[model samples]
Target: MLARHHDPIAAIATAPGRGAVGIVRVSGHGLAPFVQALLGRALRPREAHYLPFPDAQGQPIDRGLALFFPAPHSYTGEDVLELQAHGGPVVLQLLLARCLEAAQGTAGAAGTAASVLPHLRLAAPGEFTERAFLNGKIDLAQAEAIADLIDASTAAAARSAGRSLSGAFSEEIHGLRDALVHLRMLVEATLDFPEEEIDFLRKADARGQLSKLQHMLATVMQRAQQGALLREGIKAVIAGQPNAGKSSLLNALAGAELAIVTPIAGTTRDKVQQTIQIEGVPLHVIDTAGLRDSSDEVEKIGIARAWEEIAAADAVLFLHDLTRQNQPDYVAADAAIAHTLAERLPPGVPVIDVWNKTDAAPGVQPGSAPGHEAVRLSARTGEGLDTLRHLLLEAAGWQPAAEGLYIARARHTEALRAVDAHLMEAAAQLESSGPALDLLAEELRLAQNALGAITGEFGADDLLGVIFSSFCIGK
Candidate 1:
């Protein structure tokens, strides 16, 4: 347990900027003394008291609403006080300073109560939410959902995070755990009564239960993969020869002139990145320097960086200039780049062949040709862009879930995979000629532990620290 939980923590909860209102929040045990010292009166629990927030000199610093939530009923399961004031940065800072002063007995004799509010300090990042987790107000997954909701980049992602925060994900995990516990009980009972094991095991249907659990686990794992994609968008690298309309496609997809485009072969000498959403699935489009031999030292460096990006990308779009495809030199160059891409790109990373400038090269058909699967589109005229969008989603193996998804992280997906692996091992044990109940029971236990880790029911302190530290303070 963290010792700082005993200390009172205060911070400016609202974002730092000029707004109609700002809030200074404090959380700890027994905040009545501090509240009385700051507001000059006791506040009714769960009630908003419109009053003057006075300073040490009994001067009204700013009049705003003061809301108080008593212990066991507040966000952190402690006494939490929120002072809403003007959103000016200085005003919030002054209010925060006064809060610290009042908590530390820095005011006059009337405010001296060190025992009531001892060790008043600033909160670390996510300490407030961490306290809520520790106090059982929310579990670890829900706490993570709090941060995910705030950082959501899309409407779909925000909704998913909201669902997860509402304990949708935790409830599912708990339900699965309960089922595992029931199975474990049955298996262990058989071990204790070997004489009656045959009839007991037959009636218990351990194999059938395990199969059902495995199926359910697979379903959850699939949903988690989609949620993880929403949280961490796919990185797609655009690579091709110089003047292949890579920048043009980026600008068209983004619906803005984000990247400078020109007819010059080496116009884009560096990577130009733009994130665009197709059906709430973010595609981080990286338009890299065109691949080709160049005497310009800077262009060579850019080309090298482009290859590096391609190697790390989840997908690569090899754009081809349709107008120049008939030329022998251009064809040879395109073939050479294609050969290099096949050799250099990481295995399993999909590469999409895109023929650009379809408007200039009319009568050219789109779709799979002799050598590659291609999508022909005119980035300038906005033709065949929708097909490319669908293709990108398909290449990433993204299938739109029929039901709502709970926002999940990479770690959640990894844990689910671990659980699946253990379940597979357990299934293999059950199918053996002489089924080993001992080994099957151990495998189920391992699976339970892996699933529990998702909700912090069986997680290390270091894992909790890493998760919470990523959140902003006052959460």
Candidate 2:
């Protein structure tokens, strides 16, 4: 990715569709000649000029707005040219080709035999934002937040991503790193004067500082977990016997006829999925085929696939048919399925016991049963759905923070966990009868590195490649 940074890049910045207007963005150093060849005159910096975008034959391709931003003040911290033209796809493609041709012609007119400007090519995914990071305009976390904001599925997630893009997450990480650095400085100083009789850490109350830092890191980790839930969402599988209203529950939650619901048993021969948000947290709900022994080959395959989805789910909604609970066969089948669920589900994955068809069975109360946390509801009538939604949030360990949250990814949570682990080791080192200051300092340094990686202060080229490549081109 770094090797191509020196080359000028261009791409259609807008989404691939017809709209009122489209944009073609060019970014790199020394774009004055290319701008002149395309626009026929130098554009005023930061001023919008109505001009004709020309082709290789000096004919107007489209008349629209032309804006130029000089180096150090633009998004990439380099010279940038934006051409707003008609939104037709073909028109945008032609304008893009004309820009490249103009670059080639401009280089030839300047008599530069070995010029790289003529080699201007289409920008790869996320090249513009990568340049912004390289130019120190934004950190790695903020760059990721830009992509998150664009891809957010819910209002809360979008707001959190916006906060992250504004550097809220980076600022918290930086504050933790600064505290670790301060402690490291004190510990390193103690090592330098080992002959001194006075204890530097004890005099400076380093242990107290370490305690406070641990508390702060825990707080950040909690918020990061909630942010991750908002970003990645929860995968919930609706599992139960045949005709337990799993499909109806999915449709009710989604507020659309996303899944086919009927009285016929085994209507769903495969997994039907939909994503819905409850209180601004996305819930990826999958209504799988009924779990049962079947003679039909296709139904058998679907039943097998249902188990696969159940195993991978973050939460499982075990819907029971309240009207059929009195039947001997139904009771036996429910017990067998419950045993399978206990054996197959991963440890720590929660299962919510839901009794459906309550509209037909009004005498049954909606509360916990013996040795089970249960919610009785009618999927057909939408009764007790509010309780189910709140229960889902509680099972996922989601807590609304007093302050606004910043969107975070799984990698961010892992990094925070690493920092917390190192801090724990440092505290243990301090508690030893004869404190090992060297080990303490090493833990502090490790903690700082893990924390710094969140904001790109400590990262590798390959990691950057993986992070930025997920972004849309021309971002």
Candidate 3:
């Protein structure tokens, strides 16, 4: 009966391509009859039966184990079936066809056709998780956590994602919601009584409650920002004048020649990006075109794009040649470039100066710190790379802790920020002599709604569709 939401979805729950075992999962109403059509019997719920998957005309296409999960306890909270078959692409296709045929033919207890069944629909990216959210099996934040866990590149990232999936993030939001609800009750109570007897407006306790709520919201928002950083990582761009060893540095840091390096000024025109994990922090290293004035149309376009990259970069590496230091023009050029780029870069973006090719210049060792904040390094010799890495991590505000982190996305962080904003507004209203009760209540409601979005409590059907559509078909 639950299948009325749409078509039943199917997809290979296992990863694509060859494996020791492949699973094709089907979930929705009328799934039992479909399984019976192939297995040829009424199998007990939650029981695994080794049966031959029959094709049309009751012919066996492949033999495998079939497990039936009755509705209400299944992953999708619907009648679900799993057919485990040999990991052959063709073989799995045949089994899927058999399941589809069975699903199409089954009728519900009602005389009408079981149109509630999803008609063998394709599952979107994260549809199963979406269904689980709709069924109250998990909240919205947990559903997003599933995606983060799948895409985690480091152990810390995965661990954080797992914690989120386990409801660490949602629990905090729920706690905040409970506090807000209680505060709203006390504030609204003042409206029900006569002004003279209503001591609510003058109560010190009410003001204290508002203060506490604001502090709590601020704390949670700060942590959510840090969690987002760990999940999204940073985009660090290497930008400088031509032949400043940008390509060499990219190769050295990546431990591979991802970019072509030569004495040629425009050897690197396009951007090359490598996602690297340094001690579990995901870093997106972008090697951009060397910023310079060019006459060639293509090179000019590339240089302009390089500046764009620099503008958006979380951090910029303004590399320079150390040997050219004595030349007055060289010093003026570097200073001018730095000042110009600073105007274009986003506010708060940290630009680190890197003096490369220092091996050729005496008194420049990997451990030696330059008079400026810049680091002296030889990308070719792999010296001072560690210092650069540490600096990048420090810029990200990443500090290794024994535990207590969870994976979070920018969306989740935004929601938390929204909640914090509303809470602050509510606090401000409560403090006013003529209590802005209406505005305070409205802000409290907004805060609750923001928190609800994290767990699917405030999401729309279309939002659910978009979220779940990303999952594999049979998931």
Runs of candidate 3 with Cα error greater than 4 angstroms are 1-6, 106-118, 194-198, 201-204, 362-373
Full ranking by lDDT: 2, 1, 3
Q: lDDT: which is higher, 2 or 3?
A: 2
Summarize candidate 3's per-residue lDDT along 1-475 as a digit string, tens digits.
1454556777777787888899988876667665555566767888788887776566677788888888788887877888899988888887776666555654332112342243776566666666777777888888888878887888878888899999998888888888878877776676566474137655637677777877887777766766777788888899888888998998898999899988988988788899887768888898888776778888888888888888888888888888777778776777778878767977778777888986888564322223225677889898899999888877777776535777777777888888878877877776677666777778888888888887777877776777777655554
lDDT of each: 0.87, 0.88, 0.76
Candidate 2 residue 124 C-alpha distance from true site, Å: 0.6
For residue 233, give model 3's deviation from the true position in Å. Answer: 1.4
- Which model scores highest in lDDT? 2
Candidate 1 stretches greater than 4 Å from native? 113-115, 194-199, 366-373
Better of 1 and 2 by lDDT: 2
- Candidate 1 vs. true structure, TM-score: 0.95
lDDT of 2 by residue, 361-466 (tens): 9886544334455788899999999999888988988885436899999999999999999999999998887878888889999999999889998988999999
What C-alpha lDDT does candidate 1 achieve relative to the native structure? 0.87
Supply candidate 2's per-residue lDDT for 419: 94
Q: Candidates 2 and 3: which is better by TM-score?
A: 2
lDDT of 1 by residue, 1-475 (tens): 7687788899988876899999999998889988988778999999988988888777888999999999899999989999999899999999999898887677464455554566889988899999999889999999999999999989888998999999988998998899898988898888998777656867888889988998888788888888887888789999999889999999999999998988888999899999889888889999999998999999999999999999999998989889987789998898898889888977888888999998999976544424355688999999989999988888887887546888999999999989999989988987777778888889889999998899888889899999989988777
Worst 10 residues of 1 by lDDT: 364-373
Which residue pairs collide in model 2, if any?
Answer: none
